[model samples]
Target chain A: MGRRSWVGAGLGAALVGAVGVGLLVAPAGASAAPPLPPVSPEDLVSSVMTAQRGPFAGEVEVDNALGLPAVPGVPQLADGTSTVRVWSGGEDRGRVAIPSPDGERTLVSDGTTRWAYDSRDRTATRAPAGDHGGPPEGQQQDPTAAATQAIATLRQTSTVAVDGTAEVAGRAVYQLVLTPQPTERTLLREVRVAVDAETRQPLQLTVLAQGQGEPALRVGFSEITYGPQDPSLFTFTPPPGTTVRDAPARDGEQRPEGDRPRSTVGDGWDTVVIGQAPQPGDGRPRDGQDGQDQRPEGAPDLSALGQPVSGPWGSGRVITTAVATVIVTDDGRIAAGAVPQQVLTEALAR
Target chain B: MTTVSASAPPASRASTRSVAPLGRLAAAEIRWVLRRPRTLVLLGLLALVPIALGVGIALTGGPGDGDGPGLVAAVAGNGLVLPIAALGLALSLLLPLTVATAAADALAGEAAHGTLRGLLLAPVGRVRLVVMKAAGVLTVAVLAVLVVAVVGVLTGLVVVGGPSGTMITLSGTTLGLGEALGRVALVAGWTIVQLLAIAAVALAVSAFTEHPLVVLAAVLGGLIVFGVLAAVPSLEWLQPLLLTSGWTAGADALRDPLPLDGLASSTGRALVYVVLGAAVTVWQMRRRDG
Candidate 1:
């Protein structure tokens, strides 16, 4: 009877030990590390914008796991804008540009726009924001709406934690970890931000996708400048003589007023064509003139004329005829100069 | 009336009757295999390898940080190390022993036991006897591979988990889980074929030597030389010709969009080696005075 009681006690002890082990290893309740501190959206936006002022005009480096080394001159900014110019040896490969913002705008301004230009294609395309909603060309996500969406994401997905102190770019900084919620699949799982403690400027940002089996994406800034930027940097003017096309309306419905151009050129210089320029030996005149005598004499001093010159026009001669020159200033108006009456009449007829 | 039978049965009928002795010889060979303690020990060691590896992975962080639990376990238990060790165990140790144990004792063991003269007096053909002994040796080799595979996979599943899957990172594309596991299975199957080829080579070597130790040394020395040559990067082009190279063919499956170049070439070489080795063994056995 005594031996039986001893056996029962041993069995009870083993059961308790097994339960303890199960509790230790089980994945449940593993999230008890501590609830991340709450972060206000306004503070995040202000902190990000403040860090946007920097002299970031030099070569930037980016590395990935595809056996490719750090590619140089990949420009990045604090507002999440990036511009990468691809190159091979000394020749330019192409350009990829992305502009990501932290919050939506209050007024209905133009949306966040991103673009990429393939020199080979001779075409530039504007990409949609948020997700891969559409091709690179067309109308983009509304700037205000995009900002609101980003703010909502920050509120819903990100759990902010102040992760102690660190040094970045020779400045003492506070390290912050922004952990994404479980449902945010495409967004990075964690982002480490090193902010200059005193200035509240973000010095470094690292994006980590926990399940990607890849290393973290890191970007660092060096020479930083603060203050207002040149307003012209934000303005865009289309090239002269290039036709503008109305972007396709979203949802196949007519765009609202001021959302699209009224008229569009269906076929124009912007159409991408594949080929090389005709060489001089191709039996065509170098200047597209019928004969050598029709060519301008004394080479026309084409370098000095600079009248929107393209190609080998008047390369070897100058033929002085009734000349008319019309100059279009930066403002939308025409200015005429030194035009014969007959030449002006002809120009007006065209 | 029996004395009046003018001639013995025709040669063809006599040969057919002689094949009956082959069955008895094979049965005896099976008993010899069962008696060897080394065979049991080798199999036990093979079974233990996957368990040890799985335990190690579960305790450590596993192969890398981003790797899932299933992938960490698979890579640690089966993908890289186990297959290589299986090849070495089969080719360098187990296979040569099988050949030497069976072939060296084909006639010599009988002579030592005073049964050679008695067996000679039976209506058994020498060639038929030699073929039976080779069959027995090959059966042992095939059994060894199966045992190792079964125990390794089962223990691996218990300690790590199921053949859940693997993740291969390539060109920024992540493959799905099912596709990755299918590739791992293919790698494991290829490893088995390579091991069988090693057995064939050992069987051929054993046909020439009566001393089991001599047969072991010859077969093991060939493996060592091939291993050294494989290590020399300058001679990498010759890797496809070496039998041991096929052992590493599984590594192709680990790569995203599996690299067919090396795996296909090595498998072809292993097949060639197996066929040639078998042919040579049969030829040698046919001419030997058994």
Candidate 2:
């Protein structure tokens, strides 16, 4: 080759070789950043709990299998299930929604007023701050409240102990088992809670009702994130001419947040509650039922059709649903729960 | 060598007149550069870079994170990322050698062949001739890189096919075909910039030397010194100014929204070296007798 050609070819080779060295030094694209170190179970649980107390958003699912048939008037319990989505921006602002097959029932509360919106009917309900239908503002950001309540109740009635470890919602957690003592003849078999070791939050909960092998009820967060939420979710305005109902301030012990005014016969799995049946207009309609019952549309009905049956529980008509068995005693009392009739008879005997 | 104190000729007219002749010169230069058996061997070696990487990854069925992650790690995930991966693979040593050798022989080889004077007799200006040589070298260099990248993409698709076009970034964001293609172009562009730096430096070194091997050694020595300076913790302040500094910043283009800080710094440093090296070469060529 001529001198000039040699120069050209050499320069060409140089360009390729030099660039290969310069550019190829960097590694390829990817996600192999170092992972976080594992923390102890107690630390993880506390961390998750602390994390939940901050702003966060997530979805929770409820599954039930007590072999009860569909109830007449109740919307959620009749179907024996519910799904809830929660969003919060720390205390004083949050929203919890029940996304049903019919539509969505969302209750949002700031520190002041609580508002409920039904996307299906386009009706909005507003209540004074203290009387809000949803959880109070103080507990708004505490998404672990449901699990906390269950854990607290189990602790009071059963043996609370850590079994092992589990992974839930992509975080490592300690598996907490709550078993009723042999002395405690509660209807529940056991309760298992998956507590996050990092945040001390309950990531999952499983309730095994008496007589059932698999979990009778499972409730936990499916997706969860911790951060500030859009503030607008906490505020609600009745969308144009939607029917808006204003509720009085903190209506008497009529709330249905599993905190209703009721009396319990015992504690633990065998625990039975004797209370006035859920009535219409007290809380959101069950199952978002379109009022197929004899009662007015969108109203909660305490009564269900049943033939008379005499039992040691004192002659009552028994009504069974997918999740609960209700026995309306002849004496104006309704004993509705997942417990067997014999247990109710025993409660009556007590 | 002739020194002209007169004002330079009109650039537009000169550029226009130079186009056809420049094209022919470029073609002739490309023919001579590309046809050589040694050149073919070098190109074949360059093409092997991505193939070898792909085969290694394929054989391992992709290691957990595939050695060091980020650019090269894409082999473990998506084959579409292979082009970018190959570019990254080529950059460390293969690229430096290729550019250094080409630049080393640009002028020194002509002098050694005793054809420097005859080569200068062409009607083209000294600057124009230099520009043509640079263009030819750039064309060949870019082609070499393209061959490797394209071959990598094809081989990856063939051997370790993944989701057609989607690639996950280091930050875990997913990109579609369009964006990945853009990223490939950007990586190529960044490699070219760094390679241009080496080319100019080698050319300048060539102007001062009569042996191509010496020119190559100069570039090698220069890069080695720069690498050492960059490695020293106490001298880290000079890293951003080194010709070889932060060349890997181009990989950031694969990240969505494209981080600009590193890319800007690297390109700026490369540009400075390019201008400085080109100036020195021009001075040497203009002053030294043939």
Candidate 3:
């Protein structure tokens, strides 16, 4: 009888343990008897993206105890771009350095291509059309594209439910709850978003972990604009004194038929397509160092070859030298192809 | 033959009486623990600190960026807080009192109550009784440590929210939040193990002294001596050998990508302290004359 009772107890304990595990592993939404309405991922993306385009403006307040001051009078550019200029109020309290007072980045996009320019770097880069890996370096994220991608990715990896309506940034929005799919890469098992019901723009977002814990991110926007923007705002031009280099072609050399110049000084000269003439301290062979060398009569000093460039490329000097050609794509994709220098010249000439 | 049989019954009765005293002794010891105000206080305080720290951190604008998992990584995440803050509130002030208070009464308090001789006369074996007492004390210490850990972590989470992965500033690399929390849990566990070593040391001190005050003084003195030795930079090589060296091993859990340096050595040292202290105490108790 005792043995039989022990077996019964063991079975009971096992049953309890199994139930507890199930309760933990079960999706939060699964407890409801009736199934809710299914949300279409594509529709959600379109709505969020559509609401993101605007001609609006407002101030954003950022509070960082690590010496980030509250930036007031921050301007939101007409093309949905935002800019804030901060100054050293008094002594440096160790906030991360902003390049300069004008060290602002403006993000502009026309439903399709997106571009971001850092006024301090004097460089602009664009996002690839239709690609989801996000924009290249120097380009700003299209808020609409980012919102769309975030929603799509979340939907693909989670069971989502509309958690009713709420107000965010003074706008009425729909609240969403997401439960994780078995193969999700995120640590969060659930997330909530306050999206504008009519426009589909996300007003606020929050991520919650599986276990009892605090929310990971709580971000709310100040103001959002929706409507058509000036078409010319999307176009970008290289600043004066800036060099525009053509992306290198695949084969690492210029095709003979291309209209680009072919220097007799080996492929290295071809690789030098659009940079400024060398300056003093550049570490290149000075005109007197190699008697065989000749150049245009008022050529800038070539001595500064090994010296760091003063532009954005300076930080990436090591990477540029190791690769055959460095091409900054139209959408700001920085790619290094094994193509020859002559091919880069030809591609740029076109 | 009738007389002999009658005498044998008395012998049997005496043996029964002897065994009865063992049960009474065990009951009395348990009651004493239950009545102890210090033990209750220590347990209560340990549990409260983590919650308090968590709330404090949260109200203070949350955990600082450097205070998060990533900073722990840059320093190799050994989990030991400098100055022994890793003990949370216990090491800060409560732990020394817990050790001293429990062990001080081990032998001396019995003598003070004039029950030392009665306890020695009991049928219960001396070595077994001492071992049991030590076990009870160790249990209390372990409980205190556990309370601190659960409370501290819960409070930290409430204050700072969930762990965000290690923030590698230079590389701008981040790990998953769950991984960071796991690291924090591991650090808390290591701290418990370190506290267990201190408990063993206190138990050993208790076995040698009959005065509770002397035991308390000895345990506290030993801790202070070791703490002083730890602060001497020139004796750095000996730091890892100290039982207290591994106290902050939990700090290792805060690293984004966990670092294992010094962990093995610290754990080994703590284990050695526990084993050696328990062994010596058992030997002494077994050989002690009633």
TM-score of each: 0.38, 0.45, 0.39
Model 1: per-residue Cα lDDT over A1-350, one tens digit each: 25565355446544543454343334323122233334444454445543333322221234332221222222231222232211111111111122111100011001344333221111234434333344422126543455455565565656666676766544566667777555433324566887766567666777665454543466654333334433323322222211233333344332222343222211111111111222223333333233532444413322223233112211211111211233222221222322222232232223
* Superposition error at B116 for model 3 (Å): 3.3
| C-alpha-based local distance difference test score of model 3 | 0.47
A91-159 per-residue lDDT for model 2 (tens digits) = 768888764422346777886877777544445778776543565443445535644554566566677
| Docking category of candidate 3 | incorrect
Q: Report the Cα lDDT for residue A283, model 2.
A: 47
Residue A24's C-alpha lDDT in candidate 3? 33
Docking class of 2: incorrect
Off by over 4 Å in 2: A1-350, B1-20, B65-70
DockQ per model, Cα: 0.01, 0.01, 0.02
Put down candidate 3 lDDT per residue, B185-224, tens digits, no spaces: 5655665566566666676676666777777777777777
**Candidate 1 lDDT over residue span B131-205, tens digit each:** 666566666666665565555445444554422433322111123545644554565566556655665566666
lDDT of 2 by residue, B124-216 (tens): 677766776676567667877787778877777776666665665432345677787777777888888878888888888888878999987
Q: Tens digits of per-residue lDDT for model 3 on A1-350?
A: 34565455446544643554343334323222232344455456556654433343222322211111122223221112222222111111111111112123444444454444443333445554344344443126665567566666556656767766666555567677777666533334566877776667666767554442555345555444444433343434433322234323323332322433332221211223332333233333433343323444222222212323223332222122222344333222232332333344344444
**Candidate that would win on TM-score:** 2
Instruction: Classify candidate 1 by CAPRI docking class.
Output: incorrect
